[model samples]
Target: MAEITVDLIKELRERTGIGMGDCKKALVAAGGDIETAITNLRKAGMASAVKKEGRATNEGQIGFFEAKDCIALVEVNAETDFVVKNDRFQQFLTHVAEQAADTKPESLEAFLKQSYAKEKGMTVDEYRASIVQTIGENIQVKRLSIFPKKANHSYGIYTHLGGKICVVVDLEGASDEEKLAKDIAMHVAAASPLYVNAEQVPESVIEHEKEIVKSQIAGKPENVKDKIISGKIQAYCKENCLVEQPYIRDDKLTVAQFVAAKGKEEGKNLKVVSFIRWDVGQ
Candidate 1:
């Protein structure tokens, strides 16, 4: 059998985040095979996976990556804010974002299993685990969003407060309006509209808003109540929908109006196709 050395124990400790003594014991028991040692530690319930599994990872950064054909956003969470600022953590976040943009996985689970772009033969989740070992915190790639580019459409991507908030907007009917799209993205960062238009707002949400409005005006006459409720629901859509909301730069014009005015100047019919906004830890 091969003799376990100090260097071997250190490597195991670095990979598993297990204590030095436990790693040494596992290495010895597995005859200096790192993979086998990891398995043994896990079977013994003494690995870092068990130790860090339950920690709340409420803090981290949202990373944004834009490719020629798609835009990707990834949220990586850690146990504390301090780790988010670590050089290793930031590098990991960037790599993961790029990986997401390249692979365009359909879901978070699929993204986690995709190969890490920076390192060959390593899955994204494995890379995350390596970072967790280095940083000594619970790290997770919480979510991923990918927006595929459409022909004759422009995309705007914005990151605010060092990526605590990231927004992406898709605009149709013009290909050269990147600045317009970016401005809309910035507005989204500020205004936080929930849907692109009133039509996009769900019926259930409108009904819920109506319920709240009706309860507030319960003493009004039944005939008056109908008119007030209809007006209030319209107002609610104006507040929550992107196209109907007042533009962040000019409150006098709705976002839809602002886009339409710009489109008229360019002799094109512009439209807000869709938008996505991600707030860290939410």
Candidate 2:
């Protein structure tokens, strides 16, 4: 057997964070080769597909950006929240967000594959690897979103806790009241709007709502079916439309009236095109 020194055990333990005894055993098994031992330990640690590097990067920060008509958000995850706040990780996230804003990739996967502008030396994954080595833990690029501009539109973006949560909104047209767009975006971050407009409500959700309404009105006579249908449709419209939502600031005027009032005052028609919201856990 090769010599198993205390130094070997300590080094392996520090590298893998596995138990000291386990690290020592791995070293001996690898015939005092630290590299071989680390590989073996890492392989054993790979309990799940994602665990190969460590774990699903359950911790990280969100990154956000906006430029006139375009906006983007990215989530860069690391093994720990401590690393999430590290200057390097934060800078990396900013770089990734900027890259996301700059690239008009046809798809999210395509976006990840694109060379990250901030890291000239490597592709996105390779940059992540460099960070992982420096940080001594697994890091992952989770997901991102990029919004394309619409004619005459402006984008509003919100970031909380350096990216614990993010929200972006696209106003179909610009207004002198730019603050309103931000307010709307903040509301989305707080309230978590699922659909931009009633028309965008998924058919599955609508059908599910209809079923629930139908069940509730089941005991009613068949003669009132039309009335029930009409009432349910009205409820659906009121519940699903962001325009009909109670204004977050005032809680009095519906979102439609809120926008309309501002539009009139500004002498512009501001329609909402779409929005995106992201939170760490979600």
Q: Which prediction has the highest TM-score against the true structure?
A: 1
Compared with the true structure, model 2 gives a TM-score of: 0.75
Error of 1 at 175 (Å): 1.1
Please identify model 1 stretches exceeding 4 Å from their true place. 1-46
How do all models score by TM-score?
Answer: 0.84, 0.75
The lDDT, on a scale of 0 to 1, for candidate 1 is 0.87
Candidate 1 to truth, TM = 0.84
Model 2: per-residue Cα lDDT over 1-282, one tens digit each: 668999878877766665576677788889999889888755643212223365667888788766665677788888789989899998888888887888756666677667768767456755665667666778788888777666666667787766788877777667344577778888777666678778888889878877887888888887696688768876776665676678888888877788778888878888777777888857
Instruction: Please report, in order, the local distance difference test score of every candidate based on alpha carbons.
Output: 0.87, 0.74
Candidate 2: misplaced stretches above 4 Å?
A: 1-54, 175-177, 223-229
**Candidate 2 lDDT score at position 231:** 83
Looking at candidate 1, the ten consecutive residues that score lowest on lDDT are 41-50
Question: What is the C-alpha lDDT profile of model 1 across 1-282, one tens digit per residue?
Answer: 677888888888888776686678788888888999998766644575546856999988999889999988999998999999999999999988888888889999888877787888767776776676566888988999888899999888888998899999999998889999999999999999999998998999989988998889989999999999999988988988999999999999999999999999989999898999999999
